[model samples]
Target chain A: MRRIMVCVKRVVDYNVRIRVKPDGTGVVLDGVKMSVNPFDEIALEEALRIKERGEADEVVAVSIGPDDAQQQLRTALAMGADRAILVKTTDVVEPLAAAQVFLTLVQKEQPQLVILGKQAIDDDAAQTGQMLAALWDRPQATFASKVELAGAAALVTREVDAGLETIEVDLPAVVTTDLRLNEPRYVKLPDIMKAKKKPLDVVELASTGVSAGETLKSVLVEPPKPRSKGVMVKDVAGLVDALKKKGLL
Target chain B: MATVLIVGEHDGSKLNPSTARCVTCAAQISGAEVHVALFGADLAAVAPQAAALKGVTKVLSVANPANAHPLAAVLAPQVVALAGPYTHVLGPSTTFGKDLMPRVAALLGVPQVSDAMSVDGPYKFKRPTYAGNAIVTVEAPESRKLVATVRTASFEAAPQGGQAAVEAVAVSVPLPTHTRFVSVSAANSDRPDLQTAAKVVSGGRALGSKENFQLIYSLADRMGAAVGASRAAVDAGYASNELQVGQTGKIIAPELYVAIGISGAIQHLTGIKDARTIVAINKDAEAPIFEIADYGLVGDLFQILPELEKSLA
Candidate 1:
């Protein structure tokens, strides 16, 4: 039986306007609503669909972060993952370090497939899956929009800058989800109740015995430079007149 | 002295302008010796272009039959083999670089900094996150090797003038057969590339259908501009994600940007905020794009587009 692992992350909701902290430390998170990363939700949806299609036997959802991150794991559980694991850590894990943590999980679970969001919205690093694939020495298909399973391989279509590119990778590989993959199914109260009963194991980051050892560090953060405000013209003729005056014509 | 090695991206015959931009980014790091590695079966045509970049110290052309197509698996080991003396390895934060650099970073046992907007120090970088709303300054351990991808939009392309030396390098890494190049379905057009275009014309969901997008193309063609679309337009299948201009899509900053029938969402705004002159044509008087537009013409796009086209003509 083929088992798959899906990784999810908790991030600030996409709708709110993000603000920098008073100090040059990080973005303001107090009272800001947090939800599962949309790309991760799409990843979980893909895993569930794969399981439903009988291509996989079970789906495991995992997350590595602070205790609040458990809600993200539970959301994955509610979405029908067989079990959930939260690798608790007090410190922030950089992309490579985060990949190391996932590497530890893969060693224990040994799932045939590992899926992750192409990028976490919070950092927008988009390197964990690729790093994990490289560390594991397994094939990877990043930014996958369409995924199909064959006997010993999976064909994935990627959303690249040029166009959709399709590639086939052997089984036991890593796949990352993109936006156009599928619309995630909505969760219901009944599913939430069932998710509560599902097995959610908590493991300490130290127990994993993986250390990224401070590769990239965040020294300070500030808001991006603001664009100067512009004048609103009345009509197309007025716009053309303004452009011509600005020598942009 | 710290040395930076740039993994060059090229289409078989011509070198990509992104490579020159990488050189410009490397130039920002004071006193760093910038070397470009051009790997392809035929580098004779492209090596000279890389060599002429102003900041580059030398071009390492590794002419190999296996490097005809940039399979990350095949290129990662080669880059790692060549990264012996360099303190940092860099690539452009494009599809090619994003696909190739992380593997090189992993092989070299280092974490790569993605989408670096500015260099604060030899080891510190500022990058945008949460759809470019906030910029974060990331520092790296000065002791270890560093790898990063330069955000092309933030820096200008290195001017071509200085004649850097091109040296032939040997490939030492073993090639893998697991990944192969499949068919490419690129949208071939003669219009300017969206990222580098001086002028851009974009449409939104209000443009209605995929067929209606021809109006955008016609207008862009007349101005020798590139065509872009909002995420709403791409999501509705009116345009491909490649042409989508938003936070999650291509962030651009053309000199002249015209938005048609688009109500600007924050995500969309994030992509075009850097654009020099913004002209918005939306029916909604309260559309957020107006707040930033140098010229906001509120009217129905269906009626306004033909008039605008004629005015350009």
Candidate 2:
């Protein structure tokens, strides 16, 4: 393989318990901690591993977001991506638009493989990779837990609802990473310094020949209803008695 | 009338219950004439089951040798070919639908509403984001065909009373051969499926090891409940990947959910928020699982497991 393009997105850190605004507009993002989407980090780690194993020559990290997303791309470079590309935009890029941008880049880079997260934590809309594959007219293996390249095809083990399902797709396919894929390696301090010197090219979203087609509009935003506090039972006998009382036994 | 075409999910033998739940969601749309599309090598047993769903009016059965497996690349084109007559295209928000619907949306040049939990109107839906921490009402354009994946957990399965007509349709789209199905290794169990189970028993990292995790299976079997695990237990190799119940794993809604030796993380809670009744048993009294549990017990699970099973017996 010549090159592998990995897609990364900036999202609220996983540990943060997000709170919706009182006005019911959107989540508060004033001073929250942000990092690379966990699934995307795993995808980048897989790409780097493929490159390190001599299967691919270069790994390019790409993202579409505001300028702050550069911080996440730099982290990708620090984690060993050969270079990074940031498609600059201030507007919200929905999954369809994001797929279009990736499609353009895929045609330009002609990478043998493209990897991305199954879903971004913020939107939880797991659509980009499959949509991109449709636009690119290529094969898509999503929710991949294990990927092995053999000859001109890749065997991917996906984490499906029933169990593990393995499929084979020809080269130049798109794979979306699942949680069990791999634990991402941490970016060390020296690698951070080296990453600062890596070539990161920034381009406008409009220049990619893709429009931010925002079709769905958010009419209202609200927090989830909290569960009511419960009672503590003294013993297993009491638990059984209580469950029977509630008709749950 | 708004024509809503639902993609039916099946495993060659029978239709998945998720398809019925999608039918329920589609019924919420005003004046929706629901039809199910089943793509498989043979629809002998599954087509009748799809037509039996309460609100389904017709079953579009596309039988082909290449439709043996649910490949997104192969199914998306066929779905687009059949989508011209319908106004809305819907599928369950399971792995099968999640993998295929977006590709259909892109091919149709329309945006998709993923995990639509509520149908506010024909083009408006309410969906959860941030792992169920936030809910947003989204409105799609009425000019284009609307494609969506229904959140099965949020809707009840439609009753089996309808006598919908079944139509065997042949699609003439060119299927791709670049993606091939190799094999699937599914966990064979007599226990009910965790996704559609009425009762669920979930273990956590506190279960200690693979051997100790058997306590959970024993309790679940005794209670006739499905078995699930927290991500920690799966990561520690105490449980298999498919048994994990969390935001990244399976989002399920059951009548009763019992959490034993599990400290509830928000991620895990996201999966069970819709469960009707929750019971928690943990040694630590401060475990977050107790907050949402309708009944909480603080004790050693080893001691409680045997007692609970004996009481059930």
The number of the candidate with the highest lDDT is 2
Candidate 1 chain B: minimum summed lDDT over ten consecutive residues — where? B175-184
Q: Model 1 segments beyond 4 Å from truth? A: A212-214
lDDT of 1 by residue, B106-171 (tens): 877788899888888888899989888788888888888999998887888899896999999988
TM-score of chain B of each: 0.96, 0.99
Tens digit of per-residue lDDT, candidate 2, span B1-313: 6999999999999899999999999999999999999999999999999999999999999999999999999999999999999999999999999999999999998999999999999999999999999999999999999999999999999999999999999999899999999999999999999999999999999999999999999999988899999999998999998999988888899999999899999999999999999999999999999988989999999899999999999
Q: What ranges in model 2 sit over 4 Å off?
A: none
Candidate 2: give the clashing pairs.
none
lDDT of 1 at A213: 47
Window of ten residues with lowest summed lDDT in model 2 chain B: B241-250
TM-score of each: 0.97, 0.99
lDDT per residue as tens, model 2, A81-175: 99999999998899999999999999999999999999999999999999999999999999999999997999999999889999999999999
Cα distance off (Å), candidate 2, residue A114? 0.5
